[model samples]
Target: MVTPVHIRPKDDEIYLDCNATTPVLPQISRAVSHTMEQVFGNPSSSHITGLQARYILDNARRLGCEVIGAERGQLVFTSGATEGIQTAVLSALTAVRKQGQVTAGKYLLYGATEHKAVPQALAHWNELLGTKAELKAIPVDRNGLLDLDFIAQHLPHALMISTMAVNNETGVRQDLATLEKVIRQHAPGVPWMVDCVQMLGKGQLQLAQTSIDYAPFSGHKLYGPKGIGFLYVREHAAFTPLIIGGGQEQGFRSGTENLPGIAAMHTLFELLLDREQQVFKPVATLGAYREQLLAALRTAFPTLELNHAFEYSVPTTLNFSVRGVPSRDIMDVFDAANIRVSSGSACSSKVTRSYVLDAMGLDDWRSQSAIRLSFGPATEQATVDAACARIEEAAQALRHSCLLLSDTNEDFDSELDGVVQLRFDAQCCYLVIDRSAREMAVIDPIPQLADRIEKLVACQHYRVKAVVTTEPQGDDSTAAMLAQLLCASGCDAERDNVGWPLAAQADCSTPVDCDVPTDGCLLVGNRRLYRVGSRQPVYLLSSPIEPTAGARVDFAFVGEQAAPQVLESVLGEHTLVCRKWDDDFAIASQLRELKGEG
Candidate 1:
């Protein structure tokens, strides 16, 4: 479970594994360091600091665009080249798929040694594009170059083609022009894409006139800062964004721009290009060291396999697998000897298989036993010599431990700040408030008529985003409760309170303030339920009054006796106990007369 962290040894140790990830250049380091200390303003503001940071990022975008031979605005900054690779691949595939141009039974034609992000993004396209995503690896020659003939054969089923500019392990360069020519001949309409991360400054990538639709590159690979990269979506090529948010990058990408990182990376890209020819001059100084090391490797381990042919490889990378030697033990022995190298380098820990080797049809056994020694612009001849010496020593000591095994980057336990639950268990209604949360709402409200409306919301752990009276009560108690709650909670409380009491009661438990809103309320106990709003109410209850015999309000029973007319009216439609002694029957008849005519 040990992490094979590419720990750059102290000043005493030699580190030639720059391809895995390069250390920040001193110039870039100073830029990022200084910017971090000084440029801390949000770019959204229109003030001096905001405009300064914006200017820095805007210039960075321009430089990044230029480095890729793209138009001034043809580039976009991203988290890293992994995002670049994903964005370009997914966009092209989606655009083609949506237009229904690549008809049935089509597949994504890509080089075998392309970065794993390529296929991973393709998997997403398969799910989201509503089309079967078939990923077919174009065959490669033994030296790790894509076979043009193989591509010609598969172009029929391919919707798009992707090939890396150079192999990370093999140091092999892909002939972009040759690849384009073949695509034009066979699949002319299919877009050609490339991950140019490893190829940028080593030599020229004449992308201006190629059939390449998209290209991805990382800043760190080209002497820029980490956490920043760019994608070159050709000027006219229709594209879509992968990370969609706050309408930034002309609505292509959205997030507060990492201005400092952007400025540092932008400047570095410009620096890399101006010095591109001279920048890699120091690489050639290691020529003798490479020769001596390769010779030593050939003599000491006669059966060792130089996985990549040195003839057509990048001068910066070396990949070899010693026969029957396990890469892990060798890497460990070198770690102790103050030398750093890789077993199988991958961009993301999630996809750590040696995608480069896997593409070349190398079996897991040999591929796992391979180690990569990479370099950068600052690599020195002596450093190379010291690293070569340490590698020889480590390989010999770990010979017995060379078990031909591969391991992935450690999956450390990352504790994400989990979503805080707005839990509510109200035995009695209690207000909870969390000002930091965005969407918070009430579950249940108290039905008490005498409860403090303000206290219901003021005593919470959250700032209520919205309020809903699930059940409406007729009256202003609902309105009053709402007005106080809204004032206390500082939210726009919506009006859901119709005309009903908070709870069903025997007599209308309480009335609402009609000045604001009428809380839906009802009467209980002895009072009759009435449709009361403006004038006299139409009462519907068990008790009756006497105006003539048993009329109420406008008419009543005088002298503590019922009216004769009302009693006669009641007798006609009597269904109650009207005793003769009580004269209740007569009272009912008289009441019936008031009901109309007896």
Candidate 2:
């Protein structure tokens, strides 16, 4: 079992949610502090302190311009990338209107997989100005790559086009070069914006070489201070100011400049650029580290699914879904293990499904079950190894937790003749067979245990005749999946043969394949399983008969919502009461008791 990596500080959270927001590096802390303390004067003050702040701001702007490859173009500082994106998009739309492009209503085209901020910004401007510009969403394929054809076809009519350089959820990179080529070929001189928040430190962007009109970035993503971001607007691009006041930010964004944030970002950018060339090169070993972690996690959970294709996404982020496990459950497991990760975008974490994954055409199982693991330049091999070990341990514990009635206890096992009983989560699945005939049948098998059932069938070399179910009223997805697996495994039993009680006939969401009536017997191999009314059975009964009505019943399966009041009747008194899950603690306590408390 993997334990906590450290114990003293208690802040040993293995942060893997970098795409949301990265930590401010200690290297830049001093710069940020010095600027905040010494350069507190307003840049517009025109005094000694004010001039000093203004000089620092100008220097920061120059460095930002150099980093983004827009030496001649202007850089506007905002609270963060969201404001920058809003400013850029709104300015472009207004410029389009001034150019008389709204004859049929101005259009703003954006990717379906873009950050919510992009579309929301457009909406905000449209509503604020009452311009009533129409918004269009460009679709992406199952791999999360933008459909260039769709964009190219719509480029001519669109007043503005917006897309992200990299997806925050899956880390899927969009090819800006190809996008620029398409725009140049089809619709030249159009405003195009890229949300490069996720790519600030992770991707080496060459905006100066491309036809990108505007690109917004966040300093925090590059290990700089939060509440600081910049917008790069290509020279001679259409522009407007959303927050106009004292004609600050080249008569665009009007606010007291965030001098400290700008200075800190300036220093971090230079360090990050050098770090990009010298140290903390995550791109070099990220893929290999991911493989190592995956291999280790797979040892504990072989059914884990990597959600994104490697070729289409960056090496620093990995999205995975584990079958039969919910994303919330996975998050809880990781949280307990001191490994921090996210189920999806932090902005849309409240939503159960990941719209990004959904737009990529993943089914409900994959999209809702995903967890994102993002690495940073500072992440080391040792940390990755420890986190992977903890992940594997958690996965193993969770995978087998369904069978555990308590931490130390397992289901009671009973074997008689050719019959066996396997209980899990307070539920029971009985296997009955005729060894001579090589025919076997399972009663009330939980679908979550399909793998275990498949393994058992293969090991015993028994041909499954049918799967008899007692409670067919709950979510039938699990039952349906189990049926499909069993049928595909060469079992003669059909998925529709999932037995349902007549009392629950109306309550069952799935169609009842086999209606199990009271006093009715289903033949399996050479044995007969009699469905007695949920009543106490008589212990003294005849046995060793033929396979017909006269045949002796081997077992009585008590189903859900059974009644009380059973006098002795048909089958023998040896009754099997199926277990029911009360709750987590109850099951754990029962398991502990079954294993004998320490």
Least accurate 10 contiguous residues by lDDT in model 1: 411-420
User: Please, what is the whole-model Cα lDDT of each candidate in the order they appear?
Assistant: 0.58, 0.69
- Deviation in Å, model 2, residue 445 alpha carbon: 7.3
Backbone clashes in model 1: 69
Residue-level lDDT tens digits of model 1 in 1-598: 6566965347766776778788777778888877878987776669998877777877887776666666633677788878877777678777876786744577887777766778777777766776675778787867788888888888877877888888766778887877788888987777777888888767665566676778887777766677887777776776888888787666666788777678778657767667554445554654455666677566545557777777787777778876544465446555676766777674533433466666677765456567787777556666777766766765565353322222333211111111111211111221223333322333234343112223323333333433333233443554345544553233334333422222323333343212222223222222222222212111111233222232112111121233343333222232232221334565566556666656
Q: After superposition, how far is residue 146 of candidate 1 from its true place, in Å?
A: 1.2
State the lDDT at 498 in candidate 1.
29
Distance from true position, residue 412, model 1, in Å?
24
Error of 2 at 123 (Å): 2.3
